[model samples]
Target: MILFENVSKTYPGSHEALSNVSFHLHRGDMAFLTGHSGAGKSTLLKLIALIERTTRGQILIGGQNLAGVTKRKIPYFRRNIGIIFQDHRLLLDRTVFDNVALPLIIAGLDYREITRKVRAALDKVNLLNKEKQLPATLSTGEQQRVGIARAVVNKPPVLLADEPTGNLDPELSEEIMKMFEQFNQVGVTVLIASHDLELIKRMQHRTLVLGKGKLIAQFPEEDS
Candidate 1:
């Protein structure tokens, strides 16, 4: 489970990116974060992933507080949390297989193990046939799938996506959402930041809306 208790962040110039933002996501739950640009959507995810730290309050993932996690321990802490960005962030020079195998390789896994995991991830994204291709060679949607495969290659229990479908058309956007749904079904706690209201409504999952650094509403309302 992920928990945020009265969290807030302020930049060097005292610009508040998030304020007293508190929410809870149970294990295996999938939810959407929606807001306008600079609504703290990205800031919130960054906090959870430790890319940025809260100036106040605390964040806990799976019952462990993130406030005390040191710089040296951040990488290890991140290994179990997968993150996807608006840009696919693939290496244009690398093949899909190589791209997906990067995290495992960095962890010092043997070649055979890397190959097995890479193939399995690619299969999940239905891009096994494109393993040998470069990101530039695939269509926009295919490139995004490659990115998804790379993110999940390590089988992280928590997945966070920021504007994952920002560049895709509506049809492609829905397809991408379905891919997230597939991951959530298999027990990955998923949180996505998106601006597509239509898409969010269509998915019908719990949604947390942020407005100017504060959480303002939740869809379908929480149980009493």
Candidate 2:
């Protein structure tokens, strides 16, 4: 559902985030973008999320060229993708339900449908009981789960997670991974940027490794 062709990113001075990177992700597939610090994983995600435009190359999402997408249309393009972050990025002053319901409200869904989808998403994350709680009131793991709920509440076609498990213990990290796996099973194209080698080794998904802004090796899954 996503393709990057001859992609490169260079900063104002001499910094390069990615260089001539090209890859394709098919719909319903799950993959990991693995690299150490400053490897441009987040840069790649930002490009997809349209937070940053590439200095070079073309990006296509389901055949629409992002290079030509208008600023006014950016929001429409983002509606089909969900993004999760390491920081949880929740608004502490807002209740959990409001935070998760933000997207639906923006999409102009009626209150009844909004209530239904938001609650269902919270239930999937096993946080339905804490719907009324503020983000500060939940534990770190629970707050992260709430972040996941907000991301997926819109039922987006693609999921982008930037170090979603970075702040949690191993057990809680695994729990979050399983939640992502559940969504991937139902056809959310999942791309996670993570450096957790131990957890990644256990998942056994296709991995694309990058370093110093260059393409390294994309290790295909066995039995492929």
> After superposition, which runs of candidate 1 have C-alpha atoms over 4 Å from their true positions?
none
Residue 121's C-alpha lDDT in candidate 2?
100
Q: Rate the local accuracy (lDDT) of all candidates.
A: 0.93, 0.92
In Å, residue 174's CA in model 1 sits off its true spot by 1.0
Q: Could you give the C-alpha RMSD of every candidate to the true structure, in order shown?
A: 1.0, 1.6
The local distance difference test score of model 2 is 0.92
Q: Write the per-residue lDDT of candidate 1 for residues 37-88, one digit (tens) a residue.
A: 9999999999999999999999999998998899999999998898898999
**How many clashes in each candidate?**
0, 0
How far out, in Å, is residue 174 in model 2?
0.7
Model 2 RMSD in Å is 1.6
Model 2 lDDT at residue 48: 96
Give the best candidate by lDDT.
1
**lDDT per residue as tens, model 2, 81-187:** 89999998998999999999998998999999999999999999999999999999899999999999999999999999999999999999999999999999999
Candidate 2, pairs of clashing residues:
none
